[model samples]
Target: MVSARSVAVRARSGNVTRRLLTGLAAAALASATALTPSTAHATPPAHSAAVPAHALTGYWQNFNNGATVQKLKDVDDAYDIIAVAFADATGQPGAVTFSLDPAVGYASADDFKADIKAKQAAGKSVVVSVGGEKGTVSVNDEASAKNFADSINKLMDEYGFNGVDIDLENGLNSTYMAQALKAVHAAHSDVVVTMAPQTVDMQSPQNEYFKTALAIKDFLTVVNMQYYNSGSMNGCDGKVYAQGSVDFLTGLACIQLEGGLDPSQVGIGVPASSRAAGGGYVAPSVVNAALDCLTQGSNCGSFKPSKTYPGLRGAMTWSTNWDASNGNEFAGQVGSHVHALP
Candidate 1:
């Protein structure tokens, strides 16, 4: 099967130009400094209540894609970390900005910021997501890395965002991306850092996404690998598992779990409903079963782990809008199950 990510890239316009620019910028950045693995920054005190042990993360789309448009305050209580999707790329490379999608019906940016504060007050983390399937922002060099970190920190201060979500699906440079995230953590000691890499990106520790995740594992919250839109892939046991199965979820997750990621830093990411993605939609029951298999070693399919990860982080969905569109079945069932994980 064709790679779902490659297919999405082909369907969109300007990707070629974006890739070219990213390559040029990366070359310029690399020449300026010899890139090396980044050192972990000391974690600072959290700005607000810490995320729940077993949490649900959902993307709140900045633009409507036929799914229910929602205000931040209107997001369901099931989500503990609400990622505002697709922070816009700026003229300056690696810098990103966010504006409320007028389609979402917010009267002003102030209203949106207030909603963010309200969510933080309610113990939910509101983070600005930096990329999407079509995201073009690239952090390939020291300068771009600094720009990325500064801009994200600025957004956090301006909008009361607790942290940032790295969803740069197009491409990533592990060295500089790691540098940028370390700088952000240095500035906001208690920031919540999350990542949403596609399935192939985390297939091995050598992959850029996996490398970046490991570089900052000390302070990383979770790496919620997208398990949908991907066809068959190898799990930790080197078994080829197709998407939309209990084995698929548990098996792929084993790569991260066994590849040096803390159990609390690995999560399962799935589409909330069938309409949410091109393919690989599983019922919420399946998601819950996968969680059970990982954390409790029960409800497992053909593949089972050598040990249980009781501290496993929990699950994430593509978008809250899709969940609402599907009658909140994902949230009601999977959400409850995630919170009940022990």
Candidate 2:
């Protein structure tokens, strides 16, 4: 979804770049359907908090792009995990700020802090997400990595964020990113860390993004690979699955599952609405189909997983803003399906 601060990617035709689509601009279109699940316990946060029970994850944009403008407290409960998107990086090393959009409703620092706690009180995880389609933040070296860690930790304390999300789209340094995360986790053992890498960034274990995931696998919460924006890609079976198809979702997810990622650490990321992404936008039923196929091994496409992963964490959407605009179809349909999983 195109947030006031996030850049939107557009659909493009090509062999290489097409396979790398993350989140971009696009017109709204008909949605697609479903998927399955697996069960594996993730390391709980250090605090006495509720285990992550819900599966539907959504991003709460700090500003309104086209949809209704709302604050973090205004987000729907359908989202089990809510990530606050696009924390701006200050030119000074690892320093960062919320960079709330001036065009939308505004909230004071205290207002944001209170809302974050309120969301947590209701069992929702609120995390500060760094980077976006056009995010400039990066931990390129050791010093920058330290800066990243210190800055994020400061934000966590100030905003009551329980975790951090690595949505850096432009580039990633596996070593530095891992170091920064490890530093944060060292202080707050319960901190949740999520990543939103493009499809190409996850194809193999060697890719930097994939390496980063592996580097932090022990403490990582979920790696929700963006399956939209991408055009077509090969499934685990070596067959190509086109965008917006159940085969595409299951097939791509299989790559992560079989590529050394634990079932609990991998999640399917899609647009809340066609408008939220340039290309891939499937109906909630289609998403359910993909989830069922992967987790239950029923109603599957041509390519099914060799084994079921009942512990599979869940699904993620581009933004809660679009979900709200689309009548919350994504969270409504996918949320119910994920919660019903074992």
Q: Which stretches of candidate 1 lie over 4 Å from their true place?
A: 1-47
The deviation in Å at residue 228 for candidate 2 is: 0.5
* TM accuracy, model 1: 0.88
User: Which residue pairs collide in model 1, if any?
Assistant: 44-189
Overlapping backbone residue pairs in candidate 1 total 1
The TM-scores, one per candidate, come to 0.88, 0.86
Instruction: Assess the local accuracy of residue 250 in candidate 1 as a C-alpha lDDT between 0 and 100.
Output: 96
| Candidate maximizing TM-score | 1
TM-score of model 2 relative to the true fold? 0.86
Error of 1 at 270 (Å): 0.3
Per-residue lDDT for 1-342 in model 1, tens only? 113322322343210000111233233244222332132223332446788778899988777677888898888999999998868899999999988778999999999988988888888998898877767899999989988888887888788888899988788999999988877766565678999998989999999999999987767888888998888999999899998899999999999999989888988998888877777789998999999999999999999999999888889987898888888888899999999987
Residue 255 Cα positional deviation in candidate 2, in Å, after optimal superposition: 0.9
Model 2: per-residue lDDT, tens digit, 1-342? Answer: 222112343220000000111222110000100100011012323322533643677888765567656788778887877888768888877556775666556656777778878888887778888877766786878778777877887777667788788887778888877877767765455677888888888888999999998987766788888888778988888888998999999999999999988888888898888777778888889888988888899978888899997778889998888888888888788988988887
